[model samples]
Target: MTQSLAKRVEQIAPFQVMAVMARAKQLQAQGEDVIHLEVGEPDFVAPKAVNDAGQAAIANAQTGYTAATGLPELRQAISDFYQTRYQVDVAPERIIVTPGASGALILLSSLMADVGSEVLMPDPCYPCNRNFLTQVGAQARMLDCSANPDFAIDLDTLAQQWQAHTTGLWLASPANPTGSVLSKEYVAKAWQIVQQQGGHLLVDEIYQGLVFEGEDFTALSVSEDIFVVNSFSKYFAMTGWRLGWIVVPEWAVEGATKLAQNLFISAPSIAQYAALKAFDQDVLAECEARRQTLASRRATLIAGIERLGLPVAASPQGAFYIYVDVSSLTDDAMQWSLDLLEQEFVALTPGADFGQRDAHKYVRFAYTCDDARIEEALQRIERFIAA
Candidate 1:
């Protein structure tokens, strides 16, 4: 008899871009030059201070596992960061550091979700979020958010879609794929609605520091009760360090700590130590410079695409991606993405990776590379369309 796999395992969908990315890599190995606009990773390395601190930790042999809740100093630094950056007063006691924002999501999902529970989110969101809910046997109910400006969920969508079994709402500001931020006013309204409905509001602020044109409002600024997920990976440029933290209400701290202990045991001790330097003024200045670079790149890419007559469903105000409407180009974004990769050696993420709501008409481009490469890619795209 064949051994059966867990049903939850079957529920998880593949990260579709990985296949395209893998193919890109395979072609690169065979000597093809590929322009990658598929992945959301930044091209910068960790700040010098952060790298130095990590090196010092390694020299001092500070590689032991930290407490499941993470280092006290790091937590305090995060608290201070909130106070200075967002003007929000968050107690360090409410913070729990994990492997990455991914780990934090797992911890929160475990704490709040149960079998058969529904977690509401927007369609065309980060694809992995639904899988995180599924890992705990909870359902991810994606409400169609195309009608909303910025492709973010508004109070009306929340009211219409939130069912009795809905446990909480998972949100992202400076969201993936689309790179649109939910407005502070919208968040405040949604928070009040969730509270009235007796459900939780979880905001993914992983891209908090990357906004270009407006105030970078942390969800914590709206309410102390909201669960805020942030990471060192994005603006801090510490992707491989695998460090992130969650700020929950004081009541959830103990339970979250217990879950963190059982699940992660702790975040990396070295990374925790290094993250302390992430708060230094010099390091922050460097990161800010990089942010400015990304902003310029964003302007260039958007202008180029628009000049080529491609439609951007929602113009991104933050993060490093632009989700373009490819309906005029082709009805099948998935196949179109593959054809671009094959013919022009340009790789972009297809909408299939995000969600099924009009997905075939959308494609996301990452401005993670330098301006020169982005310009080259646009030129190639214009030529491909002409042909």
Candidate 2:
């Protein structure tokens, strides 16, 4: 007989993106044409400078482990990035390089949560944030966001959830799935509340560079108590690189460093070396081009979905996801998504994977594919809806 999994492991839900991608791959392998729009990975290639840096690092035998906090140059680069992008004075020593933004979440949860402590996050947000909280033995409190409000966190609801036992708050601006961006004013207000309640704030900025409109703000720029987590995945087109960093408050730096050493050993040495070149002008230009492409895809997708009579609750200003309400088509988003996969050969993520509030009526589409593929998928979806 197979041994039962640990209770902690059993409590976590399966990652929905992986499940959808696997099904899409299986269909493709069987010679079935499938348009995948479920996974939030960029279709762009890594910048040539990044590739060259990786090759150079390997040639120079930079394969051995560095400090758990990451290479000094990479850390300094990260600091400079924060300084340049957000006008925040971040010291290099405050940065901790990790496997990915996911890794940083794990580390943050472990560092912040005591058993039975509560961590509040927005509903229909990144599902992994909730799962990571559970794994750390923290109560994951979901605050349902309004579609009319562009799925942004409501300050009133957040204040209600701000209790003495609330040890942390997890926020994802230009959030996953919904692609909602929090305003600077709102972020500042929320940070003040969390600080007043004696809790830490963790901002997941993995999609920091993917904004299409308005200015992107880092939480650190607003408050020093905030722990900013970012990755090279989305904007840098380095998902497989599995490299990211966290900027902690000055006092928490030593504790976070120790946790990084104990938990991750160090981020992949080769990825760190490669990411050193991620800030070069040539690479920046390439990433900017990709951003423009995503902006175009977003416009195309919104128009297509509207034509199909599907309701997009809000216009996403950042990230490449369009969270749509498909209640008119079907109430069961999972079944609707599966039926679309089988009938229309298009893969999407059910909103249930993000949260339970009216989730059955919603579906999320990722516009990470090329323009041609996106157009094809839109046509297929239109046909499927007509049927």
TM-score, cand. 1: 0.98
In model 2, what are the clashing residue pairs, if there are any? none
Candidate 1 C-alpha RMSD relative to the actual structure: 0.9
Question: Per-residue lDDT for 178 in model 1?
Answer: 91
Instruction: Give the per-residue lDDT of model 1 (tens digit) for 1-387.
Output: 999999889888887788789889989998998998998897899998998999999999999988889999999999999999888899999999999999999999999999899999888898888998899889898888787787777676577677889989989998988988888998899999899889999999999899997679999989999999999999998999999999999989999999999999999999999999999999999999999999889999999999899989886988899999999989999989988898899999999979879989999999989999999999989988898
Query: What are the candidates' C-alpha RMSDs?
Result: 0.9, 1.5
Each prediction's whole-model lDDT (CA): 0.91, 0.86
Instruction: List candidate 1 stretches off by more than 4 Å.
Output: none
The top-ranked prediction according to TM-score is: 1
> In model 2, what is the error at residue 196, expressed in angstroms?
1.4
- Which numbered prediction scores highest in lDDT against the true structure? 1
Question: Candidate 2: where are CA atoms >4 Å away?
Answer: 1-3, 16-19, 146-148
Output the lDDT of residue 21, model 2: 68
